[model samples]
Target chain A: MSTFAEYAISAMLIIGGVFTLIGAIGLARLPDFYTRLHGPTKATTVGVGAIVISSVIYFSTLGRGIGIEEILITAFLFMTAPISANFLAKAAMHLEVRTSEKTRGQTWDQ
Target chain B: MMLTALYITIAMVTLAALLNVYRLIKGPDAPDRILALDTLYINAIALIILLGITLKTRMYLESALLIAVMGFVGTVAMAKYLKRGSVIE
Candidate 1:
């Protein structure tokens, strides 16, 4: 409600938006599937985390406090996103999804 | 103002979602599609929370939490299936 709070929320929203757009752009343009995996897991998660934290700030100051919901979602997302990303990468490796030529650590043919 | 920032963020995130959809459609591998799906749900959650902020209410929080939980499960299940060819096994 206060001008300072409004400004803080605005700044966070812009930051979140920029990071999200960057992540999506990476996902669309990355050369290989494995490379593409970097976008969503890291950038997008950070972006969403920022947005959710902003929401927490906005609602917490608005009323008695509605931050519990936001905190719950944020904690859950931060915890699970990386776990899922790791699984996705393992799955991709298991399927032998092609990687970019420059990538290192790829298993050689047996 | 908060409203203006909200509008700009919504536009940016919407464009991001469009990009995700493009990747989803054009992805060369199954994992690419799965990643796109994962990012799309995250974007959807952002939009929902933004909507709640704009409406000056706390109601959409529940739906956002639900989506977060369900989306993770779905991604993990799909990834597991891709890895083992079966989700439950």
Candidate 2:
């Protein structure tokens, strides 16, 4: 209910929104699947993390004892994003999916 | 104001979801499609959380958590299937 919390949430929302949009842009426009992978796992993860943190702050400021369940979503997302990215990357490599000509390290090691 | 920020975030997340759909449709590779799908679900979670924030409630987070869990599982399964042509051995 304080002004500080309001401003903080606003800033976080802006930052998260921008990062999420950037990640989506990268995913859509990147030339290679591998390059595109960098966007969502890193930037989008951080973006959603910020958004969720802001939500936590909002609820906690409302005298709700810090709604901790949303944090679980962030944690679970952070934990699994890399695993999914790893799986996707490995599968892409195994399948020899086409990469941009500029993309290096074409060797499938493993 | 909180209302403005919330609306902005909602718009941005919705746009991100649309982009994910674009990638899902346009991706030339299976892994690329899988990646788009993964991002789409994540965007969905973000949207749901934003909705909860707007409505001043926490109930939506449960669905967000569920989406997170299921999306991860689905991504892993699809990637595995693409890798070995079988989801479970």
Candidate 3:
């Protein structure tokens, strides 16, 4: 019989795979730097989080107790990714890199 | 059954990694490339953990943790550099 942990791991992997795929698609399809930044930051955060949760489930089911380390990493990732993205976006603006017409129409600062 | 699951996860991760590489190469600008690199590192950490599970080794988890830590540092440094034209500033 498949254990709950196995099922959980399967679900996590599937979800993570979907998120990764979406992030990749966004990266490929987004028009510009700022738009591309939005893709991985949001999608991959959830994707990686799901994978880490799956790891925790699988390890705990193996009687390894709760693996809090993955949790810590997840927290760190969630907190840091946005700040990095914001910093990058600000840097791009500071550098006066050109933006797409779509972005310019959406925001006046461009 | 477990082996099959492991293989599938690995394959998915490998595909994601390849996609990230494509983004890195095709990026028209430096910031876009940096964003791709950030994604790559996060995916890499997850891959390391998955590999650890497949290999039944705790060592890989430790390395994965290190990768996560270092990846954050690398991204932050890169972003700072892109912003100020210098990592130290």
- Compute fnat per model: 0.88, 0.88, 0.43
Please give the lDDT score at residue A25 for candidate 1.
Answer: 96
In order of appearance, the predictions have TM-scores of 0.96, 0.98, 0.90
List residue ranges in candidate 3 displaced over 4 A: A104-110
Off by over 4 Å in 1: A108-110
* C-alpha lDDT of residue A14 in model 2: 87
TM-score for chain B considered on its own, for each of the candidates = 0.98, 0.97, 0.94
- lDDT (tens digit, per residue) of candidate 3 on B1-89: 55666677778777888888998998777877888898899889878878877775556777777877888888889878877678884
lDDT of 1 by residue, B13-86 (tens): 99999999999999788999999999999999999998998998888989999999999999999999998889
Best by TM-score: 2
Question: What C-alpha lDDT values do all the predictions have?
Answer: 0.90, 0.92, 0.79
Highest DockQ against the true fold, candidate: 2
**Clashing pairs in model 3, backbone N/Cα/C closer than 3 A:** none
Q: lDDT tens string, model 3, A1-110?
A: 25766877888877886787688778878787778888788998888888888788777777878877788888888998898888778777766666778764443233
Model 2, runs deviating above 4 Å: none
Model 2 Cα lDDT, one tens digit per residue, A11-102: 99989999999999999998888999999999999999999989999999998888778878998999999999999999999998888899
- The docking category that best describes candidate 2 is high
